[model samples]
Target: MPGYEAKAAQLAKMGADLIRPSGAPPFMLLGYAEERELIAGWAKKYGVQMFTSGQNHVRALRTLGIKKFVGATYFPERMNRVFARYFADAGFQVLALEGIDAPFAEVPKVPPEKILAFMKETAAKHKDAEGIYMLGSAWKTVEIIDRLEKETGLTVVHAGPARTWETQLRLGLRHPIQGYGRLLAEMPG
Candidate 1:
């Protein structure tokens, strides 16, 4: 991911090409949120509606009235700082931000148990946090979201479900989706 910004336009073009054939109104849900301006430009160039995981996470938190959160992820400490700043820039109070320091490719393989434990521990330490914001979509997190919310008594927002909820709303699909998380199950599309 070192040169991701340099290659973003090309990647966006490739993504647009892959999405164009679907025949429905074209849209893209970008996996990362760091390069929003560049991604928005490419999306405009491709004439596709674009949403980023980070943006959707912020939206979900705002909709849930969660202003203070503990930002967690599978990324390294550096990326965790970046995510913390991203949330702060979006007007949220990042009570704490930490990660497992896992490499990008290894994220999907991170066990669900670790994710659940990490978030719970982080949330426990940050008693003032209203929610837990878990960045990155590659990890298997949806299954543990309900458990986290139930156990921590804090809203848990993960990237994949947030983007899916936003995309569903964009596509005019407003029906509540259960079993994923509160964002999709409770928030109006």
Candidate 2:
């Protein structure tokens, strides 16, 4: 992946929309302030929104005084749970929590039914939580999130699902998303 960055830049330029402008954005999740600036510039040029991981978006939002969010966490990792408690104690509301990938870490796979139950329990426990957030890229959360919303009657947002949504929004695609989550199999282009 050493030269992958350079290759991405080259491709961005070549595939950039000419009618839009010169400064098209490159959605990135693992970058610093400079990359944020570059993406912001490109977004302005192409009239596109800057796509970012929820973590980054949360950080940026916090720095700018936005203190509330409902986020997804994979399963129930001890450390991530600790972080969630910290955020909650810090006055940030966690609307939804998703991430049952503990099986990948040698923990038993908590079934989707259990996850939905936990959400219901947690939501009742934390009345300030507004919705549910799903975590992980390949956690098979899209369809689960949709189902969770139906059962719990709450809003659901998954990480990969959000990425798909943002991509489709940028590409101006309006397709029916039925199988997985709202935007799991649906992408912009």
Candidate 3:
């Protein structure tokens, strides 16, 4: 989470295709207000596109008129609670939450199946939830979102692919990816 500016610049210079910083600690530890913008600025200095964590999800939620959510996260309770505030500030109601409290290094080890289970379990608590949130980018969720939607009958929004969804709308790239979820295939674009 430290030296993300230098690290992002280094990766950009090395020809990384996109800059997707995939965790909250960098933003949480640095303080999202000023430092988050600083991180975005750093990415731009090197001609890279970045999807800052919570912002991407917020854009999707706002665009889709998703106001109620059930949250599942790989972050510890403290950090996840911080994210809850962000959701509240955006005028979304968090019906309930379930999380791992796992350390950052252990997050990726959480299987996609486990991710599905957590989301489904939390979604079950509030069938009225307008959307479901998967808050950690490190979780291997690429293969689970669509299945989770089928299993839970809720629109699942995730952290990792948030940019592509938001950018698609920004650039009017509306065709769905086919496997992820309505947010990708069927969002208003």
lDDT top scorer: 3
lDDT by residue (1-189, candidate 3, tens digit) is: 447767788889999766766565556445445545776687668887766666677777777678999987776677677777767766789887568656779888887877777777778878799888877667888788888888877777886556677776656467667798878777664
Model 1: residues with Cα > 4 Å off, grouped in runs: 1-47
Error of 3 at 95 (Å): 2.0
Residue lDDT tens for model 1, 1-189: 225433445656565432211100111122234346645665676666655556567778888889999967666676566667777777889999888767879888889999999999999898999998887768898899988898999988887778777777777678777887788788564
lDDT values for all models = 0.71, 0.49, 0.74
TM-score for predicted model 2 compared with the true structure: 0.56
lDDT per residue for candidate 2 within 1-189, as digits (tens), equals: 234344445546676432221111122222334445655665565543444453333343343343544554554555456545544544566544444455555433556676666666665655554455544454544446777766655455555555555555556765657755433443323
Give the range of the ten consecutive residues with the poorest summed lDDT in model 3. Answer: 27-36
Candidate 3, residue 89: CA error in Å? 1.6
How close is every model to the real structure, measured as TM-score?
0.77, 0.56, 0.75
lDDT-wise, the better of 1 and 3 is 3
